[model samples]
Each structure stands twice: as C-alpha cells, then as structure tokens.
Target: MTQAPGDVVLIGGGHTHIQVMTAFGRRPEPGLRLVLISDQTHAPYSGMLPGHLAGLYRRDEMLIDLAALAEATGTTLILARATGLDLARRQVLCDGRAPVDYHLASIDVGIIPDLSGIAGADRDGLAVKPIGSFLARCDAILGAAVDEGRLRDVAVVGNGAAGVELAFALAARLRARAQASPPARITLIGSGPVVATLNAGVRRHIHRALDRHGIARRDGVRIVAVEAGAVVTATNERIAADTVLISTRARPPRWLGETGLELSQDGSVATAPTLLAMGREDVFAVGDCATILEHSREKAGVFAVRQGPVLARNIRRRWRGEELERHRPQTAYLVILMTGDGRAIAGRGAWLAAEGRLVWWLKDWIDRRFMARFQTAI
Candidate 1:
C-alpha cells in the first residue's frame, strides 16, 4: 500500500500523545506517515508516580516504553529534542538533527518547574519534573542514606497535588526504611492549604494525614529563597532542611512561545475546542503543554488522557478536510489521590470527600489497569 504522502508528527511522548500513537497504530490513516519525536525513550505515567516514589511500584511499572510503542505503531521515532518551529516553512527544528517536516503537527511536551526566579533554587533544590532524572537522584539520595544510616530532613515546597503527593511519598518511604535512624523529618511548605484545589474536606483530611505521619506543615508561607541546609520564607522564617523538592507552579518551556502559536499568559499554547492551535488548524497541542482556552481546565493528567482520542480524531479529520469535533472537557471529575502510603483520598468538589485504605486499593487497581494497556500493542 502506498503510504500517506504527508507526515503527521507527534512531539513529546506524554499521556495524550501516547494514546494517539496507539490509536493510529491500530487503524492508521490511509496515506499519512506517523512520526514521534521525543528525547526520552520511556514516558512516566504521572498517575502512578507518587506510588513509585513511595516504593509501592517498581520504576518500570510506571513507565511506558515509548520506543516499543512507536515500533508497534509503525512510527518513525526520532530521538531528539525539538528546539523550535518554523511555522512559515512548516518544519520543526530539532537539536543535532535535520528539521522534521509535516503536514500537521501536535505538541504534547509537558511543562517544567519554574525555578528561574528563586534564589539558589536551581542549585540547592531539586524540582520534581523530568521525572526520570528526579527519580534517579532520589534513588541515589535515599540509597546513600539507607547505607550510611543517616536521617535527612526533607522539605517539599508546593501545595498542589504534585507537592503534597511528593511530601507524603517521601515520608512514607523514609518511615518504611529499615534504617533505625530517627524518622526523617518531612516538611510540606505551601502558600495555602495543601491540595487547595480539592474539596475543603479533602484538604482537612490531608492535613490530618500529615499529622499522622509527623510531617510538619507550613501553610501560608511563601519560600523566598533556598539556602544550604534551609529554606527562607517570605516572613523571614528560615526552615531548616537538608533536602528540598520543588513541585510548585509548572511553567511551559521557553520554546513554546517561539512557535508563533497563540499562548496564554503562563506560556502554554492556547488552543480551541477542536484542540487546534488558535488561528492554525494544521497545528495542535495537548496535555500540559497546551491550554484549552474555552474550558480553562486545571493542568491534570485526566483531561490529557481524555483529550487523546479527540486529538487523534481531529488530526485525521483535518487531513480529510472534515469539520473537527469540539472536545467537551468535564467540569467536575472524581479525584482519588495517593496519600504516599497504602491509602488514598477520594473526593469530588468541596462537598464530597473520604479517606481510607479502600480508596487506595481502588486507586491502585485503576492505575494498574491503565498501565496494563501499554504492556502490549493497541
């Protein structure tokens, strides 16, 4: 069969892009060639990352082999980082490689931690991003501590889901360690209540969980600077810590703004309901890299997963000269967040929330099922 003459390029092996890869691999578009460009061979599943951090899952369990997925989908995998775009020429310039030309392109490159402005943060603190690297560093840190019988104080900065989860995971891992050293002091620092986006009831339960784990809470404290062995707060309070993990506000890569795509104030590509970059139907963006301008949903993995099929269908539709479908992002979705141990918190909005080991079991089951799909080709 003569393959599609033009190329459908996918940048970044994030959740949504992986889904598209799988779908296209199963029933590929007649003539369109599929290509995937990513710097990492395996894409970490964020849903199970907290569990991995907490030692509940092995590293391989939470990672999707992007290389294998690309092979299964008959995609040309390019192991290179996309540096920028030439919209006029419709080419994606990559580092150390020739530009990738495409009739249509979709970007799902997730955001990175914004530690540029913070003093000493880039040097002293570790940002919980580029998960692979962070995990490697964490393994080294914990492994050395376990071998040396040292207890290190850990401070997690960020009140969001990522921050709260990391704090809990660190506490859980430290508590479970066989070392007899005094339980590692874990502190969670946030400008507001932890997991503030969740229901108030859920937030309170999380606070109680912190207490149960003996993790200190410093709410309403803005970290102004990170110094050696401590973090300085805006209130002139210096919190002592040997390790700092940053899970604060995620910022889009600087190159996204250079793509000539419409971007929100925070630097994510602005896209229409069709998931197409505004003013350009040939270009699309999804996952944490793109902002749904109309819905303005929170940057969560659930929406990204939900957007996968829509993005896939729309990309094909655009090639077929058909009207693209609008993606209706759900306003309210269930939240079952890991609490760093074998338990979880399940809740909806402010009115609905609960905690228990059962929730953890449910979360575990769901996460495992999600990962199981990628174990084989679609």
Candidate 2:
C-alpha cells in the first residue's frame, strides 16, 4: 500500500478534532490522508469534567484515547505540542519533530488558564484549566490532606460555571473526606455572580447547590494577588486559604499569537464561516482556540463537538476542491449541571430548573453514551 501525501493535519485532540477522527474512521476518504497531532494521549471530555472531579467517573472513563482513535481512524498520530504555524508555508511546527506540511490544517488546541497577569498566581495558586496538570496537583493535595491531619482552607477564585462546578465538587469531596477526619473550609469567590452567563433559573439552581454544600459564595470579590497562606482581593481583603483554585476566563495558548494568523483581541485564532482561519483557506480552527466570525458563543465543549462533523466535511471538501459548508450553532442548548451529589439541574433558555436524581441519571446516561463512542474498540 502506498502512503499518500497528507490532506488534513489537525493540531490538538480537542472534542471537534476527535469527532473528525471518528468520522474518518467510520468512513475514510480515499487519497486524503488524515493526521492528528496532540500533546496528550488521552483528551478529557469537558462535559464530564465536573462529574469526574466529584468522583462520579474515573479519569480513564472520561478521556478519549487519541492514540487509539487515530489507529481506528487510520490517521497518523503525532504526540507533540504545536508551537507555531507558518501560514505562508502551510506547515505546523511542533516542539520536537520535523515540520508537518499540510494541504489543510485545523487547530483545536484548546485554551489555557490566564494567570500571567495575576500576581503570584503562576507560582502559588493551582490553575485548573489544563485537566492533565490539575489532576496531578489534585492527587498531591488529597494526599497531603490525608497525611498532615490539617484541614486545608481551599479558595476557588472564579464564579463561572467551571468554578461553580469545581467548587461544588471540591466541597463535596472534602466534606466526604472530613466525615472521617477534620473538615476543610471551602470558599468560592468571584468578581461577579457565579454562572452569570447562564439563565436565571440555572443560576438559582447552582446557587442552591452551593448553599446546600455549605460552599461560601463571595460575589463582587476580586483576587488581587495570591500568597502562600492567603489570597488578597482587590479591596485588600486578605482571605486565609491553604490552596487556591484558579478557574477564571480561559486564554488561548501563547503559541497561537506567534503564528501570524489573524487573532481576536482576546488572542483566539480568527476563523471564517467554514471554520478556516481568516485569509488562510488552507488553515482551519475550532474549539476554545478559535473565534468564529459569523456566530460567537461561550467556549463550551458542546459547540466543539457539534462543529466536528462540519469541520471534517469542510476539510475533506477542501482536499477535493469542493465547496465548504457553514456551521450554524443553535441559539440555546440544554444545560445539565451536576450538583456533585446524585442530583442534577436541567435548564434550557429561560425555562425553570428541573432538579432531581433522575435528571442526574439521565445526564449520566447521555454522557456515558457519548463517551462510549471513543472507547477502544474490541
């Protein structure tokens, strides 16, 4: 069998890229080679993240194995970080390997937590955007709590969905552990209301969950700096905390800025209707790493996964010199949030919240079904 030249080179094993891999696996395009380059072998599904943190699912169960996915899809898997891109040359520059020339490239490298401007946060606080790094630190924190006989005060600095979910998960996990030992104090601080982007009903449901867990919510509070034993807010309010969890707004990886591609003010790669990088048809991007021009929304994995089929089709179309397809995202999506217990809240648009263990079970069933698609095939 002759190895044809590559057609599409995808950087990052994000949800969209994984979907592309699955599509190619099930129905491969002849003469169009697919290649996937990713830093992590297993890509964690963001939707199941809160559940995983709350001990509802194991790490392995929540991850999509990129190596296995590539194998199943008959795609070349390159284990490396994409450092930069040469738009003119149409090549992806990786950390340690030779440049991969591509007919078309799609970036789904996801965003990183912005801690550069926050004082002492880079060194003192735990930035929990990159799941791989956070998991390692979580193990260490859990171990220390068990051995030291000290009830560490954990302070979460973001009040968004990610932060709220994380706070709930941490509070539940800590309280469970504390039932057998000393209790750890959990505080959730934010400059704005937690889950402010969500609808009113969803916000209320999340607040109720936080209240039920005894997770302190400090709204209108901003962290000015992070220190060893405390976090100083913007108003010079020093809060005593042993561990700080940073889940603030996500920023694109710095490497994207150096790629010479058109970028939004926030540093996300700019993309066209077809998800291709602006002014560069050969390049494409999606997931949290991209800022789509036609329609903009929050950086959610649901959109990334939804964009996968369109991206895959567009890539194939570009390879075949066919017309590209435009992706139209739905105005609203059903948000199912886990309460870190056996219950969940379901909200759609301005609809009232429906809370019950049955909702959690339904959400679990849906998430598990979605995850099963990427598992290693027998």
Candidate 3:
C-alpha cells in the first residue's frame, strides 16, 4: 500500500526520534505526515537511568510517555515491534501487521546486550540494557536479598562506566535495605581497568570512590559463566553472589543481520556523518543502533542527543530541496558517573577529573534541562 507522498516514519521512540517529533510539532509542513513506530510506550532518558536505579528519581519521572508525545505532536504512534524493513518498497515490516509505507525512515532502536557467548547467563544473569526490564529484575533480586536476612554478595560483570555506576547504584539500594542488618557485599568483576578509556585521574577517582564505599574491585578477570548464586571466572575461580548483573557493551540485534544496510565492525548500522545510512539517503540511523562510518565514536547518549537537531534539520532540508547538514560529534564531552550517595564523578576533556556533591548537582541540572526541552511543552 502506498502512503502519503510526504510520510516520514520514525522506527523507534529513542532520544533522536523524540527530537524529530518535537521539531515537527513546533513547525508544521502543510502536506507532510509523521508516524512513530515504537515497541515500548515509554522511552527511558539515559542520563536519569542510574538515578532511577539509585532511587534518586521515580520511574515515571525518568521515562518519556511516547504515546502522549505522539498525541501532542499529531503523529501516528504504532505500538508494534519493527521486525525488518522492505527498503525496496519503502515499507516497514512489523510482527503482526501489514507493512507500513514511508517516503523516509529513521532508526534509533538501541543495541541489545550481548550475552549469547556467556555460558549460563541466559538462566542466571540479568542484563542491564533494555533498562526497564533490568530495573524490574533488580527489584525482584532486592526483595529476595532482603528476605535472606544475611549479607549477600553481588557481582557486576563489565568494567565500563555503565557497569561501574550500576555497581554503585546496586550497592546503595542494598545498603539501604539492610539498614542495621548485614551489609551487602558488592564486587565489580571485569577483564580490564574500570572505564579503561578515561584518563588516569578519572580512573583513580573512581577507584577511590569504590574504596570509600567498600565495594570490592576484581580486575583482570573475565567472567566466563554465570551460575546460580555464583559467577565462574575465566580461570574457573568462582565468586559467590546472590545476584549477577551483566552490563556488557552492544551486541547488534539479531534482526540487523537481515537488514541490507551496511553495518560497522560491531554490527551496528553504518551511518554517515550526516546521520544517514551509508549509501541510503532515504534511511537515517542514529543512537546506539548506528555506527558512524567515519570519525568513529563510542555509542554514548551524547552523540545521539547532539545528532537530534541535525537529523531534524536535514530531513526538513531534504524535503524542501535544500542542502543537508552534516552532524559533527564532539571529540571530547563531559562524563558524569553517579555514586548513588549524593555525590558524582565527573571528567571533562582529557586532563580534568573530580568527584563531589557539587558534581552531582551539575549533572542533575544538565539532565533536568535536557528533559525540560521536551517535557515542558508537551
């Protein structure tokens, strides 16, 4: 079936896609129509996720109601999973619905946490991506830990910034639950230095914070398997844990293998600097699901947030037969890690690193400001 001549379909309700919706809402195109296809009704704001886990923010406060936003913007919202795309027909294929046609499409569905290679993880480990489910799982585990009435050991697998903050958040939650009871033991297990890519000072600050919180650090050990009540290391040493959390980096969604678009080494859609899928102008990809073919950057939320404006402008420009704008991602952006204790670790550029309650306030201000951009008018 043919859609309107100017129908632009957004494939996910991610950060960049939300910007597109807001742009169209604030400015109208006489004949253009917008449709957003989202598998979930709520979009989690990345900056506030850790805070949510740490009980700093309520769940609803950290989630954007995509349905409401779509209604406010006059965009059709399809609550269905996009299985794949029929690029030849300019249509999106869904799980149980007829393909929807589009003149242009953008993808911002986030990456899946790769756990296929880790033995026993499927049954015993909890993944930290698809943040909503992870939070729920953590709650269940927290309940179980409370009933146990003893000091429980927790293992966080992965040493990146995410894994680190998750460890801290879990520690705070468990500590609060224990009160005068046995204090929970938390161990961060990884194969390398925590936030290995950051500067020496930043890593040191994180280490100091971990020490301050009494969280044990286990480095140079890869978690080979997650079993019931314990995690087995590469050398077969077992670390006892009541809960195991997997916070590994991106693993391309299995369905991406079917998409004809070019993909990067890590299996994300290969997008040009302009946020367009390489060799396919009709399709634009951003956020964690896309990889910039040139000037490679980490799949961090900063890039997606920065790309939103350019993506909106480029789409409008192309529709109006104007020149397109290329998105230039900053080489160095600020990094803030919440310690779950009213304090935060922050790093800017390459040389500076600091930790304090002031840093947490700064981070909170920036996060609230970003949310306000969409929340205030909607």
TM-score of each: 0.97, 0.96, 0.96
Q: For every model in order, what is the number of clashing pairs?
A: 2, 0, 0
Local accuracy by lDDT, each model: 0.87, 0.85, 0.86
lDDT of model number 2: 0.85
| Tens digits of lDDT, candidate 3, 36-65 | 999898888988988888889988888888
Better candidate by lDDT, 1 or 3: 1
Enumerate residue pairs that collide in model 2: none
Put the candidates in TM-score order, highest first: 1, 3, 2
Ordering by lDDT: 1, 3, 2
lDDT of 1 at 152: 68
Worst 10 residues of 2 by lDDT: 1-10
For 161-279, candidate 2 gives per-residue lDDT tens digits of 78888887887677666652557778999998887777888887888888888888899998989998899988888998888889997799999999889998789998887998889
Where does model 2 exceed 4 Å of error? 1-5
Writing each residue's lDDT as its tens digit, candidate 1 over 1-378 gives 123588988989999988888888889888898899999899899998889988899999999999898898898999999998899999998999999998999999999989865689988888888788888887887678667766467899997888888888887788778473766788999988788788889988888888988889988899989998899998878998888889988888899998889998789999999999999968899999998899998889899989999999998888888899999899888888788767898888659898999999999998898888777857
TM-score of 1: 0.97
In TM-score terms, candidate 2 sits at: 0.96
